[model samples]
Target: MLKVQEIRELIKLVDQSNIEEFVYEHEGSKVEMKKKAGIAVPVAVSPSVQPVVQEVVHMEQKPVQTAALQTETKQEPAAAEAEQIDTSNLHQVVSPMVGTFYQSPSPETDAYVKQGSKVTKDSILCIVEAMKLFNEIEAEVEGEIVEILVKDGQLVEYGQPLFLVKPE
Candidate 1:
């Protein structure tokens, strides 16, 4: 089995290279990666892996283009709404790694922080679980929690905003 750091390094290498697909197998572990729409998605297959067969079908471009245009039009308002927010005074706390965001230490516990919660630099804000490891995320700045950007148990990408804080 590959270590987490090794997997992260592999991901970085694959992302930087021009290769569209990559596959690695050692012993019983298999790692498959592919680029789709310029995004690198990595999949780790277990020891007992089964080959997947996919069928490709040809489609007309005109209807797809029209649908894409309509989707873009519908998303314009959300962009406009986001532009109206004053983010100058807020500090974004971003995820340090790709993981599942957990608002509390456990399911039965209260959240570490919520809107209006005051925090110091050493305060624990949440936990980000990656590869069965629970990493405690801290409030790196002294501030009040302004917003929680993700929901509990949501998968988060590296450098993605997890919280907005109004710094004191």
Candidate 2:
């Protein structure tokens, strides 16, 4: 059985970040959550507890709510801060082997990060599928993805510029 404490923790996690949805299901228990315009609605389904359903009531508070949420996110922590990237001279992270460079782990999934995505030194920029093996390509430097030089599922050559990053 899922407890109220667990639900509260989930709500706290949602409040602390830009994540829009949280869903978890295990052993006949399911919890689904959605946050629209800074209001979170959580629904939990478990065998032993009665269901709690809440209707989404959109009020005439869009501008105020969005601004408040934005302020809160900025004040909490700078998770999405754009690093000071020197774009005048862009650095290129080249592929080490000949393979198909995938922007994502799977075809049906979204890219690991989009252009203008800030990355740390150890962030995986993309994946290279070669000889039936999928090898992850890591960013050699901390920067923002200035340009994607290769398309998804495109065959990339050795030492090719899979992406161009502007270093911080």
Candidate 3:
């Protein structure tokens, strides 16, 4: 199991290195860490990688079948639309942590935003649930969501691209 100091050091490393990914094993469980792919991923508290904390983030599941279907169908039109935009200067939105990322608040709800959606810094684009906490991930720049790189609830690695945003 990781110690408190270890966790803190890990967080420091993530920030200092601009590295987007990290992980740890504790008691019979393994937790992965990642910064938001495009923007830094948010942790509830400044992530310090505290050892033996009550929280652990697991990111090892496949996307729900339904969510995959939704991505496939919805992404086609979005991709078509995105193709029309110039992408040479697009910025990316990355995963913050190793957890289940939900495009919407819940499965039955519409997504918080979609491709072509205009967003600015602080605009929440999605939720990454870690250790039962739903952390809202916000956009850090003004841009258009040109592409979504990860499907809802898919296991995302640290620094994995969640969305590709084309800055205006």
User: For this target, which candidate reaches the highest lDDT against the unseen true structure?
Assistant: 1
Worst 10 residues of 3 by lDDT: 54-63
Ranking by TM-score: 1, 3, 2
Instruction: Summarize candidate 2's per-residue lDDT along 25-110 as a digit string, tens digits.
Output: 75677877778666555645455432322212122224446766895666422223323444458888999887678999887888
Candidate 1's residue-wise lDDT over 78-132, tens digit each? 4576557678999889999977899999999999999899999999999998767
User: Would you estimate the TM-scores of all the predictions?
Assistant: 0.63, 0.48, 0.50
Best by TM-score: 1
Q: Which regions of candidate 3 are displaced past 4 Å?
A: 1-87
lDDT of 1 at 95: 96
Distance from true position, residue 59, model 3, in Å?
Answer: 14
State the RMSD for candidate 1: 6.8
Q: How far is candidate 2 from the true structure (C-alpha RMSD, Å)?
A: 14.2
Report lDDT per candidate. 0.74, 0.69, 0.66
Error of 2 at 4 (Å): 55
